[model samples]
Target: MAVRPPQQDGDEPDTLEFGIAALSPHLSKSDLTFPATTDEVVRELGDPAIPYDANGNTVRLSEALGAVRATQFDTQRELLDALHPVLEEYRESGGGILSQLRALLPF
Candidate 1:
């Protein structure tokens, strides 16, 4: 099943959304404490799929966090910074001929 984002009370998205900024909403929850490990973040957020590529294909939060260098993040800013490069790299890995071929396939 595709992952669905939570509905916001307002139409405007949070301004903290800059890099893996798609994740800002998930990370901003009061229930989720900071100084979290990647695993902790994944667990808290329920491993939702994040849009990763230029083509808008998504990978699970856990899957994308796999490539992040920092295992622990003291704050949301630290986590977002660590994830920025990883997400950027993932974005570059898509929208190729193979992806196009996959779109044509029945599965």
Candidate 2:
């Protein structure tokens, strides 16, 4: 996704958008729903080329959230990481332009 930082005058940033992978192995038989898994979520929306400070390290949401709660970093990267997949899912499920625009807003 094109993640634009907040503007100086407190206005919204330019659009940030990206594609998510299809729900494949995670899909269930009933209605083809996929259980939200960290790996699947990350794989679908993560920027593989982007460098992570922890390098090859990976962890589940619970673990990541725990770390965040403990103030591992001043801010939580996991929140941003988690939002991408959800936004992708909403877009793919036929969310309109307004909805997409809302999703692009910084938290």
Candidate 3:
């Protein structure tokens, strides 16, 4: 999905987009769903790639979040909630040219 930053002074803002990995359709049903915990995600995804800090030391997910004063949620609803702000930002960015053109139509 793509999201443009808020417009300013009638000028368009830069567009930002994120990628999400989808499971292959050919995969068996057993590999399609995730377990009900973050720990399971770690096991399934095989240990998230650790990022390095300014000091060149690897940082864990919690440590990275802590550095930015942020935290992660594990529950489904909570996970969606955590993503809400970003969704809102994209919503506010308005649809692209197609949407604007559609608005100009009387039908």
Best by lDDT: 1
Separate clash counts for every candidate:
0, 0, 0
Q: Candidate 3 has which clashing residue pairs, if any?
A: none
Q: lDDT of each prediction vs. the true structure?
A: 0.70, 0.36, 0.35
Query: How high a TM-score does candidate 3 get?
Result: 0.26
Q: What is the C-alpha RMSD of each candidate to the true structure, in Å?
A: 6.8, 16.1, 16.1
Per-residue accuracy of model 3 over 1-107 as CA lDDT, tens digit each: 34555567656536533311111111122332432344443344443323121111222323222332224444534533443443333334443365456658998
| Candidate 1 per-residue C-alpha lDDT over 1-107 given as tens digits, one digit per residue, 9 for 90 to 100 | 12334557777333322237667767776367889998899989999877764345666788778888789999888887887787776667663476667879999
Query: What is the C-alpha lDDT profile of model 2 across 1-107, one tens digit per residue?
Result: 34454456656536332321112112222232134344443444442422111111122333333323232222224444444454444335534475456658896
Q: Candidate 1: TM-score? A: 0.70
Please give the distance, in angstroms, between residue 106's alpha carbon in candidate 2 and its true position after superposition: 29
Per-prediction TM-score: 0.70, 0.23, 0.26
- Give candidate 1 misplaced runs (Cα > 4 Å): 1-19, 95-101
RMSD of 2: 16.1
Which candidate comes out best when scored by TM-score? 1
